[model samples]
Target: MQKILLLSVSAGAGHVRAAEAIRAYANIGDAHLEVLHLDVMQYVTAGFRKIYTDFYIKLVNKAPALWGYLYNSSNDAQADSSIEKLRQKLERMNARALLKEITAFKPDAIICTHFLPAEILSRQLKKEVLNCPVWVQVTDFDLHRMWVHEGMAGYFAANDEVAFRMQAQGIAAEKISVTGIPIMPSFTAVASREQCAAEFGLDGKRTTILLMGGGAGLGSLDAIAARLLAMEGDFQLIAMAGKNEAALAALQALSLRYPGRVLPQGFTDKVERLMACVDLVVTKPGGLTTSECLAMGLPMIVNAPIPGQEERNADFLLEQGVALKAFDAVTLEYRIRYLLDNPSKLAEMSIKARALGRPAAGQQVLDTVLSQHP
Candidate 1:
């Protein structure tokens, strides 16, 4: 079997989610492929994951400006060394062990969904210890300097804009391919909205809005859902309280009060189905979710995108005329009502969103990796 190790991180859900989608895509047929999904953070200590996760959440919530500044300022070649050193220390325990295992697999190609493992592998290549073609799959529409490395065999970006940015940063133009982020196969192939609603037992007549807060359910989703429900509109709400049992229970209790109008879901693997049925999506603008929404051609009401990467995603969607941004409860409610009331505008946005979709990104990336290695 041709070994293809997929590396990702568990700090947030987007990276691992993207990695899973690619793995699923690669394992569809009699392709002699052995896919291993790894969380690089798991190789590190528990304290390391805690500190990094906490710091990321706090930085995004409490100090967005500082985060933005850091993101913008760190876009240089010089910063790569510091980042690599930090990753080395975090993965010190199993770095060599994992590397040996991968090398033993004698993989034809290695794919990376997260940057940390890519960085480690790049370091190994620099030292002449690793000699495989490394393909970096950038999940976000915007490319940071960290995502661009000197020795990457190929870069799969989300759009032409990101590819252009990579080319500007000294990466060869031929080495960059604009393949939209890989989403679950369901997103690429699913039933129509009416069919999906029938399957979910959702009323097709009502305007359905699906609200999500990534995997951890880390956002003020309750407030936003309440505000939407309070608005006197003909809309049904489905709030996905991802991986947060307390939040799901709280929303479930609220759903009891609203009865048929509100539905709360726990962590589910059926987001593509939900997106297919929903008229509008209200969620934080994580890259993977945003890409999935685009694939489903669902118009979005962005709640709160984190300052650095997600902000870029929101901007890209807005520029494409496929989404709108509403930062607070009142604004979000108004936007939802306005869109729901005007079917023409909603139809137009959805059309634009579908036009921007790239459903074959996973296959495209796979082909690129195969061609380069062959």
Candidate 2:
């Protein structure tokens, strides 16, 4: 058996979800491969863990402009080598036990869904501590300089644009694979809209829209939901407040005020099912969420994406004709109204989304790795 260690950081759910998706795909009758998925942050100190997980969320939510500046400023490999070296040293120190896990597993190959482990493992590789090949799957439509390490055996890109970016930055074209971002297999599978609608007590044909602001209050689900509810249309809304209890409560109140029209949902594993019946998704274009939308062939009205990889993801979606972006509530309202009033445009967006979706990406990543290792 070929053992593969899949490491992810919990800086956001996307990394962890991407790792799990790969592991899940491997288990679907691929008995020759053994995959272990881990959250590397759990091996570090609580304070360090918070810096990786909580600080990122707080930074983006509280001070997005600073985050954008930092993100853009760090995109070049030559831009901040010294500062990055210092951070990498800190990462290796805080994440030393990650080496212990790798040693214990002694896997044939390693795949990292997040860059932290890849950087740490790259350090170890220099000293011949771990001799196996390490690969990286970038969990976004855009690539950051931090992700462009020297020791990777191969790299997975979400699309051709990112592949080109990697090559532009000196990575060999042979090492890059355009596999899209791995999403849960459920998204790609066939789901019945009528059944999903009945399960959620929704009308299957009412020009429904799915609204998600992500868990971190990134796009203000409450405010956006209020505006959408106030609009005049023959539509029902499914507003998802992912892990945000306050947002959930506010949405519940909206449901009361607009009974039978507004469906309020908290964090759910049933997003694919809810997505089955909805005609459009108004979302903050996080990488994993956007990939899921694409896999479902759902048209998107991207609402105020955070100013970094998300904005980049939105740009790609817009360029591909799969989505339209709205920077504020007024723009979002106008765009949604326009789409609802024009069925042909929405249908076109859905077709484009499907054309761009890579639902089998999880299997593809596994196949690429095993082809080399086995």
Candidate 3:
């Protein structure tokens, strides 16, 4: 059996989800390949993990302009030194245990879904501590400078644009491939509209709008839902408040207010099933969720993406014509009505989205890693 270690961090749910998706797809394609998933936080203390995650959320939510400034500033040539400093910091905190765990696993290959592990493992390779191939899957539409590292066996990008970014950052063109962000297998196999309606208690003939607040339910979803509810249209709305109890409760109350027209769902494992039937998705442009929407051929309404990576992702979506951005409740409602009023325009965006979606990204990533290792 070929053992593969999949390293991810829970800084955001996207990284962990991407790692799991690749592992699942690899098993489906090659039963003999054994993939082990590890959270990079395991190397550090719980306090460290909490502080990192909390600081990230606070920075994005409370001081997005500062985050954007830092994100942009880090893209300069001086960022190399910053990254080295970060690696050294991690080295001082957790590198020894992480290296020990990796060596003990004796895996044929290591794959990282987050940059932290990739950088840490790169240091190991440089130090001649672990002798195995290392691969990284960049889980976002845009490549951050922090993700660039030397000594990777290969790197998987969401598109050719990201691959070019990687090459420009000194990675070899041959080492990078444009495989869309890896997503769950459920996204690859979509149900028809009628089939989805039967399964989810939705109306097949009515326009269906999906409102999602991302994994941790981090957005102004309640406000968005109210605005959409006030809009004049023949539509059914499905709002997914992922892991946010307060949001789910609020949406549930709204469902009562709207009767059968609104449906509220809590954190769910069935996003693909819902995506399969939706006419459009109103969401924050997180990499993994937006990729799933694209795979389902659903056009997106992205409103005020958290600065830095999400803003960059929204920009890419807008450039590709698969999504429309509305930063406020009024504009969001206007965009929804515009799409609902013009089926032809919605259909065109769906076509563009489908053209951009790569449903087989997981399988492609697995194949690339295995081919390089063998």
Superposed model 3: Cα runs more than 4 Å off: 77-87, 214-219
Per-residue lDDT value at 360 in model 1: 71
Clashing pairs in 3: none
Taking the tens digit of each residue's C-alpha lDDT, what string does model 1 give over 1-374?
A: 77777888876788888889888888884367677777877665567677657677778777877878877776643654887566556655547756876777788788899877787788788888888888899989899877766578888989989989988888898888888998876777887778878877788777888988632222366656776788887789888988889888889888878888877888888888888778888878888888888888889888667778989999999999999988766677678878978999999999998888887777788777866765
- Candidate 3 TM-score versus the reference: 0.95
Task: Indicate whether candidate 1 or candidate 3 has the larger lDDT.
Answer: 3
Using lDDT as the measure, what is the rank order of every candidate, best first? Answer: 2, 3, 1
Query: For residue 185, what is the lDDT in candidate 1?
Result: 68
Looking at model 1, the pairs that clash are none
Predicted structure 2, TM vs. truth: 0.95
Candidates' RMSD to native:
2.6, 1.9, 2.2
Error of 2 at 354 (Å): 0.6
Q: Which candidate is the best by lDDT?
A: 2
Q: Model 1: number of clashes?
A: 0
lDDT of model 1, residue 143: 90
lDDT at 27 for candidate 2?
A: 88
Model 2, 108-127: lDDT tens digits are 99999998888888878888
